[model samples]
Target: MARTVTPEIVAHVKRFEGCKLFAYPDPGSVNGEPWTIGYGHTSDSFLKVRKGMTITQAQADAALEHDLNEVADAVERLVKVHLTDNQFGALVSFAFNVGNKAFANSSLLKKLNAGNYDAVPAELARWNKNDGKVMKGLTNRRAAEAGLWAKGSFVASNTVEAAPGNPIKDLTKPETITAAGGLLSGAAALATGSPAIQIAVGICLVVAVGVIAFLVIRKATR
Candidate 1:
């Protein structure tokens, strides 16, 4: 089974990915093929985003956990070597951004599986492009992922600032709904689930209402 990433990693990913309440195009995606919403989430996620659609923060948070959990599961399936919490988190973040298929087919995966752990950071750096162009955002995200990867290795050093970003967000403040505690709560919950089945079915039920509400809101707006 895949290990869950710490809240810090979740925050690291959310910070770079950033969130928008409304649906928008993937800057990295050519022709804006897949619409995205609520923290760079796309049709590839559990909750599909479309043009003119908007999502509440609660729903967006749920979608993020669902997506991240899937990525963690993928990391578990593909990588044969052992990893520390930080190493695991770093890979999860990378896979989350690049897509499981891309990560699976990547030379980085091949190198890591070959036990060339030290080569991974450099391998990760090669992926700092999108649509045949190098993106500053992708470059920064890759650097962060590399830093995270290094931090968990024997090469861990002081220069590795604990991923650059805002501190972990407490989404359950009085300003938000109580049910929405799953913002961070959901990720932690799924990350620590005792049984393997919880990774899928349990997570969906937790956020099912949010999905329904989003549809209701979209219809009312139309």
Candidate 2:
């Protein structure tokens, strides 16, 4: 039997990445308002639809352990085949934060479930933002998910066929640049030229001379 990855580890990873799990004090805030929840660091805790309670570490830890089974089951059905422990944990963490229905409808999960593994990274990249803009937090989360997606291998449920796609191999080729251009007009003054460079150099020398003269005058006056 395959070994199960625990939710405790997933929770720890999410927290370490600075996601808010519950409305409790920020990970280390110790005094901030209750903010995130679930096996994930879900930030939308104030929606009032599924209201959450402020929890102690003991409570949060227990909830994590309990939620692992639910998350793992969801991953099993969502994936085309068996996933590595890391892959399982990563998706489970995603589901924990985003909710099972969101996972169900996700382009990432749909691609995986359809065995269209090649498209997983694009789906992963789609999650690279909240509020329609890129952020460091989402970028890191997408990176983690992409790593997991690459690690997972698909095979027929009963047969022995390899599902295609290798993200690492796909990434090895350098990107092609089809178009290129130059600097904007009127930007040349900011640039250094033989004459411009000498002028800039002279300006620095004059500034230095002024500073030295002021210091010497101050000394003499003293």
All candidates' lDDT scores?
Answer: 0.80, 0.57
For lDDT, the strongest prediction is 1
Considering every candidate listed, which one attains the maximal TM-score? 1
lDDT of 2 by residue, 30-81 (tens): 3464344543333332232123555555555545555655666777776776
Candidate 1's TM-score reads 0.65
lDDT (tens digit, per residue) of candidate 1 on 73-159: 999999999888888899999999888999999999999999988889898899888778998998999999999888845533568
Clashing pairs in 2: 20-41, 21-36, 21-37, 22-36, 22-37, 23-34, 23-35
**Which residue segments of model 1 deviate by more than 4 Å?**
28-32, 156-222
RMSD of each: 25.3, 19.2
Candidate 2 runs further than 4 Å off: 1-3, 7-12, 16-54, 151-222
